[model samples]
Target: MTTSTGQPLAAQRILVTGGAGTIGSHVVDLLLEADAAEVVVLDNFARGRMENLAEAEAVGGDRLTVVTGDINDPALVRDVISGIDVVFHLAALRITQCAEQPRLALESLVDGTFTVIEAAVAADVKKVITSSSASVYGLAESFPTTERHHPYNNDTFYGAAKAFNEGMLRSFHAMNGLDYVALRYFNVYGPRMDTHGLYTEVLIRWMERISRGEAPLIFGDGAATMDFVHVRDIARANLLAARADVTDTVYNIATSTETSLKGLADALLAVMDSDLKAVHGPERAVNGVTRRLADISAAARDLGWTPEIGLSDGLDDLVTWWRHAAQPAVAG
Candidate 1:
């Protein structure tokens, strides 16, 4: 669904942390399309891109302000959050980065998020939509993992931080009456995807290699799968989470479909119109998880949201955008 169809958050002055990053950019774009009174994007450009904000800026005009600052800066967060109606916090260290630097991750994800919530509480903001990860599910033992799953498996520092943030939300909600929605996103990929972050989805890394006429490499037997969702659909999810009546709750943001790496590679090849075969490599233990598919019933039932882009269509859209962006421009 297009952003215009959503219930307008009348006179909302929203703040989207990391608003220039891959998924965050889409969030900002949709907020503008839904006619938020103003959208203030707070990002440090560590992973965020300036060009990503172009579309939002065009639509937002004077209503959009891009703040250059880190989330760990409590002072900056407090100042930026004033007069904000709601917040969509997406800024955080990558999973791999968090794994490599635990201390930094602690301060960034935990302290950083705490700072956001604290500021929102002080400002008496209306709502908060936190972007969490599916990593917390950690080697699911059941199909279509539901929100009622057991406490997060001690997987990685990134997952730990996400779980901690959820706790903080619940506590703040109980104590200070904070209204928030926590979304655990699955293996998300689309246009403006990042490969250097945490775990590079084999889809992107493979596409990069195949575009260079190399084989799409798969780890293990390529039997393991992931529930992939498009960034735009995720953007839509963020919007719904922001406006929906659902509060003090968590939902899995996914399309409820699993596609193996082999399947994903084949889809990529077909999209690129290439004939290269996939190369299977030795399996590494770090690749974790045999398969994953989210139980999206809660999101559908509570938020009235469902992902529209399927695997083939989403990958096609992603490949087209990536290919155009990767091409060298001729001198005008």
Candidate 2:
């Protein structure tokens, strides 16, 4: 398949770090569907599961290779990256994990990212598309945060690490002529979302309560808002970034629409046909950012990508998957 600009992925060799994770797995499927020559997946299985790659494995046959390894292992990363044309670096610790284990966060986000960049440059890969986060904006100074928005308000360890990775990519591009693109993802939710993560747990918890005929709990006044983007759309953005001619820049991968906690609860209840109202609890001690909305025009203009799923449709999809699939084990 070719991008809007006619960049063909038909014969490209691709490497997706953390390729068994939620978004990464979807990307692997897309790459195979696009008829890429070869797709290699390197992951430690810490947060990613092999079951996520079942579909890709069935479809890709000999075209896909899954390596159970760590990105921080320099030798392993180098070996995996060799002969690869494009690298999708999606391996990293979650925000809550970063907060709990700062040392591990540095090793994985900083050191692991460095290892991937070094390997990609050494292999002379065409481009490296990496995952950044909305955490970098912390409490945005403006409503719909743009790509140019300063990350001055970010104070979390995870945000700092992502910011550092972006800077590191830029430096590599300037010094070694390494082409790269950083995608700043908003709240991503879908079939395989992390059920135990601090951010996404709300959805799982709420649904569980609703299933038991209990009220969904909401901390504070339910005024805290976030920009939720579906995992499929996020995966599509990664492919678009890979195929686009633009490089050495970052873009916000989000649906510009903002939904408050209350709004989200209402939507879920409506979707499930539940009569239980959301119960209000005490204010959260660390709410972090109270509001989040992204400016996705840059992505649309440059990558020719826009979110295709609406929140209601996305939530319905998640609910259906949850009902059919076994309860996901808690993510470490």
Candidate 3:
């Protein structure tokens, strides 16, 4: 397999912690397609399903390996990291879910992260690319959020845990010479995303509701702005970051653009060819983000990575996949 740049990645042994997840599976796809020597999918299956792993394996054939494990288990993480050259850490409890189960979120995002880093250090892994949320920015003081934003305000515990894990990674890199990149991800969406239950992404949920002949609910007057980047773009960035010149500590993995909730509905409806009106729902316990747009100048300069797929084009692909995904599974 060749990267978009036509470079082969067959020399690298890569491990993605949440490799069966929506974003992580895409990362695995990019890694294996780019010709990675081995692509290990390390996931606990808490939120991710085995079918996702099988899909990637089916595409990449012998290049992909699935490992069922938790990042919090130090011994298991150490064993997994022992022979890997690069690690992409994407495991975490979701934002709203974390708000409900703060303790579990902390255990996965914080303690689990510490275990990953310590194992990397002990194994002398070459590089680690971690996923940090734009939620860490909280209610942005400025439009177009940058990497320079101060650590999370007293917002959700999920963001706080991401903040702490990022800080820890930086500290390890500085003190222990553990090469690392922390990617502050804005809203990421694409195919294989969970759309059934409480953990589904907003776009997937809306698509599911529309598919079910039901109107989707819009909270907060549908004015809340979010930065939606395609999962493939993020997967490209992870591969780029794996080999990118990394004197810097972190990079914001996003397009410097914002999308409102209404904009999202409009895009989805147009993509799905549906006229279903969205009903405004009561604002739930989860706090809404006012604005989210990344300052990707640093990502471009540092990782040589920037998103190329716009939301409209990506949605066309995503909706097609979702529609077909609604059908019964085909045997592998």
lDDT, each prediction: 0.86, 0.90, 0.81
lDDT tens digits by residue: candidate 2, 66-158: 999999999999999999989999999888888889999999999999999999999998889999999888899997899899999999999
Rank by TM-score, highest first: 2, 1, 3
> What would you estimate as the lDDT of candidate 1?
0.86
Model 1 TM-score, all chains together: 0.93
The C-alpha local distance difference test score for the whole of candidate 2 amounts to 0.90
Pitting candidate 1 against candidate 3, the one with the higher TM-score is: 1
**Cα RMSDs of all predictions?**
4.4, 2.9, 4.5
Clashes by residue pair, model 2: none
- Residues 1-332 of candidate 3: C-alpha lDDT, one tens digit per residue: 72221223567888899998888998887887777889888899888887676667788888888889999999899888888888899988888788888888888889999999999889888888899888788888876667887864538888888889888987997899788888988888887777664666677777767877777778768888888898889888888887776733778887787888988898888888888888888876567567787888988987789899999999998898888774422211
Q: Please report the candidate that would top lDDT against the real structure.
A: 2
- Supply candidate 1's per-residue lDDT for 172: 99
CA shift of 63, model 3, Å: 2.7
Error of 3 at 80 (Å): 1.3
Q: Tens-digit lDDT track for model 1 on 1-332?
A: 52221234657999999999999999998888888899999999888888788888888899889999999999999999999988999998888788889999998899999999999999998889999988887888777899988655558888888988999999999999888999999989998776454445556677778877888988788898889999999998988887776788999999999888888888889988999988999997764778889999999998889999988899899888877763322211
